[model samples]
Target: MKFRKKVDKVLGTSLAIIMGVMVINVLWQVFTRFVMGAPSSFTDELARYLMIWVGVLGAAYISGKRMHVAIDLLPSRLNKEGQTKLKTFVNWVIIIFCLAAFVIGGLRLVYITFTLRQSSPALQIPLAVVYSVIPVSGILIIYYKLSDIINKEL
Candidate 1:
């Protein structure tokens, strides 16, 4: 539980920082384009990449809080025991999906991007750096879900 709380704090803080930077980047981009009459070259790409991080990390944060979107109709109708079982099953499903889709697939994507030396045109940074968030968020989600199971939060 302490570890979970720490993870939540770190993820939340990191997301907040990334969002702040993204907002500033966008504002700079606008200021440059309109006020300076010459748009900064890297701002757009930086903002886009920061957005990707914010979105992926935000999803993990939401999962940790058990605040992700869900249809509660079935669970609402279930008895306590039934709801517990259903929630556990759903948690496992989420874990499996994140492992397969985010961790495995994301690693492959990151590897390929690194191998090819793909980069954003404007920022000239490796694309793999941006894509790395996929696996990181996947692991975070997996950790949160496993914690849920272990803590019997279902």
Candidate 2:
């Protein structure tokens, strides 16, 4: 559990750094395009790549923070004992579905692209690099969900 928390913190920090880099890349692109009259073709591509990293890494951070959008009305209404039970049920359901969709669908997407040997158009980077985030992010979600369930039960 402690190890997982540490990993989550590392991933969160990496996400923050990637987001910062993406912002800086966009700023540079704008400055060069307007002020210097020399727009960069590669910056956009880099930004896009960084965006993938940001989103995947950020998902785990948001999950850890409990920041994802939720309709809390139902949970908010329950009595304390009922609420605890319902919360556990909801956590289990969430873990099942999230892990299933992310693992199954994400794997399919990556497999198709990998078999095709595709690459990004402007960046010329392999498609696998772009799509690798799917599984990494998915697995992270699975791990965190397991942690949540364990913590709740204990």
Candidate 3:
């Protein structure tokens, strides 16, 4: 649990870096696209990938911090106790789904990448790089969700 606390701190820092990078890269892309009339070949794709990491990694931090948006349209019916139960159930479901995709879907993606030897059109970067992020994010999300549940119970 102590180690997890440290990990949460590290992840929090990563969240900040990811956000800054995504924002800066997107702004630069916009500038280059509109002002220079020549967007960098890889900026768009890179920004997209960065956004993916930002979103996925941010999910973990948000989950850990209990910062995710939850609409309680029926707040009277779904009080805090109900919300807590629902969140726990949702987190469990998320853990299951994410683990499945990371283990099964990730392997398939890796296999496809190696088999086809596909790369990005502009950057010629290995396509596996993008797909690999999916599994990584899944793993992180699972870890964070479980940690949150455990910490909450404790």
Candidate 4:
């Protein structure tokens, strides 16, 4: 419970900060392009990178909160035990998918990007740095799913 709360706080803060930066960057891009007759190339690239982080982090945060969109129709009608079992099964499936696809695949991508020394064209930031969010968020999702399973009332 305590760990979940802490994770939630950190993730929420990170999302908020990144979203704020993205908003500002977009506004600046607009202002410079239209009013100043000059466009900031870096802002667009930075905003795109920030959006990727925000999306993955936001997903992890939602997983922690068990707020991800789901079809609750059947579960809602089921008995407590049935509902618990259904939720557990679904959670396990999600965990497995995250492990296989996000953690494993994302790590592979990160390694490739790092080895190739790939960098964003506009910002010159390492692509690996941006791609790192995938595995990190996958780990976070696993943590939250385990926490949810353990703390479930049913």
Q: Could you tell me the TM-score of candidate 2? A: 0.88
Residue pairs in collision within model 4: none
Best by lDDT: 1
Where is model 4 poorest over a 10-residue stretch in terms of lDDT? Answer: 145-154
Cα misplacement distance, residue 7 of candidate 1 (Å):
0.6
Question: What's model 4's lDDT at 70?
Answer: 90
Position 63, candidate 2: lDDT: 74
Which pairs in model 2 have colliding backbones? Answer: none
Taking all chains together, each candidate's TM-score versus the true structure is 0.98, 0.88, 0.74, 0.96
Candidate with more favorable, higher lDDT: 3 or 4:
4
| CA RMSD per model (angstroms) | 0.6, 1.9, 3.2, 1.1
For model 1 the local lDDT of residue 151 reads 94
Give one digit per residue, the lDDT tens place, for model 3 in 1-154. 7877787898888878878887888888889999999987777888877787777677767766667787756554786888778878878987899888775688689679968999988778888877776777677777878887987751
Q: Comparing 1 and 2 by lDDT, which wins?
A: 1
Q: What's the distance in Å from true for residue 94, model 3? A: 2.2
Q: Write the per-residue lDDT of candidate 1 for residues 39-63, one digit (tens) a residue.
A: 9999988988898898898999999
**Deviation of model 2 at 8, angstroms:** 2.1
Residue 37 in model 3: lDDT: 97
